[model samples]
Target: MAGHAGLTTHVLDTARGRPAAGVRVELFAVEGGERRRVAGAVTNADGRTDAPLIERGSLTPGTFELTFHVAPYFEGFEAAPAVPFLDLVTLRFTVSDASGHYHVPLVMTPWSYSTYRGS
Candidate 1:
């Protein structure tokens, strides 16, 4: 795996117009209808994991999941509603190129969220 494949993520809070720090993120590998967690991390001040969830040379071709804990994050915001609209946001995607980089970015608010595969 000389040209290793890896995965990274970034979280942005649109409501606050800043990075979503302290957010808990989890990575899971899906296989035969069973899900196994691969890694867990907390978003840093820059709204990014301290290290790639899937480090270089470890990624493989398969379906994977990234879960973001949002309710607890919104709880700290005074502008958030009494009952948050989002709790756990999970993005399920497949990695087809084992030698390419995958960057999943999450942009979210209390009521809405979006994600995309970036460079």
Candidate 2:
């Protein structure tokens, strides 16, 4: 379908008050209790992927997952803990409407993280 259906993501480092650049992200499509990787992306300087994880024409109704690799990004900060409290942050969500746009954004720290359905 050539609607606006797509999947996008961004990561913000709340502890450092900046975008968490160079963080690794993996996208997976879940089916029948198995996870199949669909794509991978890396956040840019603006904490956003260069392209949508799922392009407009390619989105569909299904269970999808996004795993953010955060520990290494936090390690660049001076106040980062010796042992990180948060590491791989995985967010699983469902896409019920193929014509809908899904913007999943993450605001994170070394100790905590949060996400929301963005515009």
Reference-based TM-score of each model: 0.95, 0.94
Q: Roughly what TM-score does model 2 have, to 2 decimal places?
A: 0.94
Q: Tens digit of lDDT per residue, candidate 1, span 49-84?
A: 999999988899999999999999999688888999
lDDT tens per residue, model 2, 1-119? 34657999999988888998999999999999899999999999999999999888788999998999999888867788888888899999999988888999999989999999887
Task: Give me the candidate number with maximum lDDT.
Answer: 1
Candidate 1: C-alpha lDDT: 0.93
TM-score, candidate number 1: 0.95
Could you say which candidate leads in TM-score? Answer: 1
What lDDT is obtained when candidate 2 is compared to the true structure?
A: 0.91
